[model samples]
Target: MSDSEKQCCAPKRSRAGRPPDPAKDQAIMKAARDLFLERGFSGTTIEEIAANASVSKVTVYKRFCDKETLFEKCVRKEIGRMAEAFDVGDGSSEGLEQRLNAFGLKLTKFLTRPNHVALDRVMGQEFAQVPSLGKRMFEAGPGQSRARLAAVLQEACDDGILTCDDPLRAAEDLLVLWRGFIEVELKFAVRPAIDEESVRERVEHGTRTFLRAYQR
Candidate 1:
């Protein structure tokens, strides 16, 4: 055989596997969130999530062991946003009351979204059926948020703006006093609805009430 013919007959090397894209994980989680909100937990499927995210089933499965894990990831992401808002800001120039008032309104605005309402309803309905879901959601979202709020409260105590021996207890009480059942009422579609105006009004009232209890 000619040398050129022998060279041409050499076996071609297989292509190396493509590196995993980090953005695909975000896409999968975003798609999963939309589907979960629209279809509820039982109605959604991994195949739909894969198609919606423009990723393969193997890709999805590689990141998440099961549909339940994927669902938790989506919920946790939103919950993180919620907790971020509740953690409040570190503004030395602003008065403690002002910071708290802003924080309350910020948290209200974040939680009162249509998608948030949908998530609450879906999670509430399915929490019983999926035992670990509630715990995961709590730990990832509310629990962390409580700790963050506690930190802010402790800062206020150090500043002498508030007198709180146990910041955790104070934070929990503040949350309950500010939001509490209002979230449940808003999520469940209580009469007259929980509009922006009403929510803000409630937040204002709660802030005032909380300041009275905690402020120096």
Candidate 2:
């Protein structure tokens, strides 16, 4: 009944279980993305996704509210991971060219990936069917990434590394530089697929162009 005795008698804390299987989650997301891309959001069903994922409907619902929410989370997570891969420097010792080239390559690799491209197609096809889905996609994926890039650019400007008057506008311009090439690749299929050498070349060219325009 004493304090020490009572404390000792308290229930022991339960040890946390092993971390959730990331591979399972990834499989589910991948399956869902593939289905969405192949069938469009309206065509794809939770049952189909569950079957593709080799999971029960209950499991899928436990993780996501519905098909739209699951799709949003999957696409957002993919974009978020790619954005995190960009090495946006703190405008410290690393040269502007290096930082810019790194960012360009990272963005290029991400946008060119088949899955990401497919996700874009799915969104375009579904936007009319689910108007708010477009807004959700923007806020979760590109919008978040662009905001982060703008912040980094603003820091670079503050450090006199660049002369960006409006970081957001500059970010848009930076992205636009590659839009044509990306469209060509996806549409005409004329551009080469993304690879180490190709990515390097594109990054270098983009960095030079960016600096030419923005250098103080």
Candidate 3:
């Protein structure tokens, strides 16, 4: 066989000697994310992450190619957790209002968390410094959530349940309703972190108001 063919046909390497430790991975990710949030991306260092994670620099590098890659992974991990809230059920059995209320509540709680608020600040700073990183993070996180929400709105419109002419715009409107100006308040510490009752009340009001505007 030619060198290329032989290389392609070679036995795949087995990763059986020792499995990667999920605990260690989680520790590293948590450490890196917290550090990034506390001290903007430019201020954070791989050595600091390793020290905080209680792992060696070699261990950090083994899992992530470099600090940039590690930062990206950390961002994705945090956003991925938040993205779960966007999976409002298929618009079949559940009423759209119920789904929207549920989604709003979950999203509000996630976004208002201290860590998440800090993340938004760090993300903004990073975006100013490295637009590409910001773009990628937005695409992976909020952009995707908006698209998912738009999909739900479009489905409702197709079913004649809502009268949305523009699903994306409607989605944006609904999200704004749910979020309001809470993030700004939290970021500036002008208002305390929202409690669960406040979140529920906000979400319920937002869902009702959204339906009033969009319901067919």
Candidate 4:
């Protein structure tokens, strides 16, 4: 047998050993996220997160190099999940109002969550100190969300539902409608809770305003 033939016949490594528990990873990330939200990045500690997760300090260290790395991972994961929530449904034949309302409601619900509000606050407080964090937040969170929204808007435009020349800019404007209110409430802690009625009202009003400007 030639050396090349022998190499090609080498046994592949088995992945049969107990796979790393995704549940445990989720629990650890959730614990870290909550702690980071409750206390700003500087105030949160790895030991505190380990205790909250019911895992050993060594385990935490094995998973993440330090607080910054863990926080970045948590933020990126959360952003990806939020982006998934806005995935446009199969509504190609639906009325513009209906589609806009559905998207608006989903977006409002996401923005008004207490955890998301807490995350926004944490990012605001830390971004100046850690520039890379800002970049990651933009790329994974706002940037990704904007791109998704723009694609949907473009589709709507093509279907004659809207008159958008620049879907990206239009999407940004639509996002501003919900984001402005959330940012104000979170930054100042002015509103303790966003009731369901409030969420519905925001979505309805924002959707109407967006349609009015962009409708064909």
Candidate of highest lDDT: 3
Task: Write the residue-wise lDDT of candidate 1 on 1-216 in tens digits.
Answer: 233322312223336755556788889999998898777777888789999999877667767766777776765676556545534445442456666666676677667667667767767767787668778767766786677778878988888878888999998887777676776876767843567787778777887787788878
> Local distance difference test, per candidate?
0.72, 0.70, 0.77, 0.71
Per-residue lDDT of candidate 2, residues 127-186 (tens digit): 877779888877877797778778877878888878977999998887776443764576
As a TM-score, model 4 comes out at: 0.75
Clash-forming residue pairs, model 2: none
Model 4 lDDT tens row, 1-216: 233322322123348865566676678899998887777677788788989998876666656656666787876776566555445455453455565566666667766778667766766767888788778767766787788778878988888777888999999998887555665775578887787787778777876788778887
Candidate 1 total steric clashes: 0
In Å, residue 135's CA in model 2 sits off its true spot by: 0.9
Ranking by TM-score: 3, 1, 4, 2
Question: 2 or 3, which is superior by lDDT?
Answer: 3
Model 1, residue pairs in steric clash: none
Task: Give the TM-score of each candidate.
Answer: 0.76, 0.74, 0.76, 0.75
Model 3 error, position 73 (Å): 2.9
Instruction: Tell me which residue pairs clash in candidate 3.
Output: none
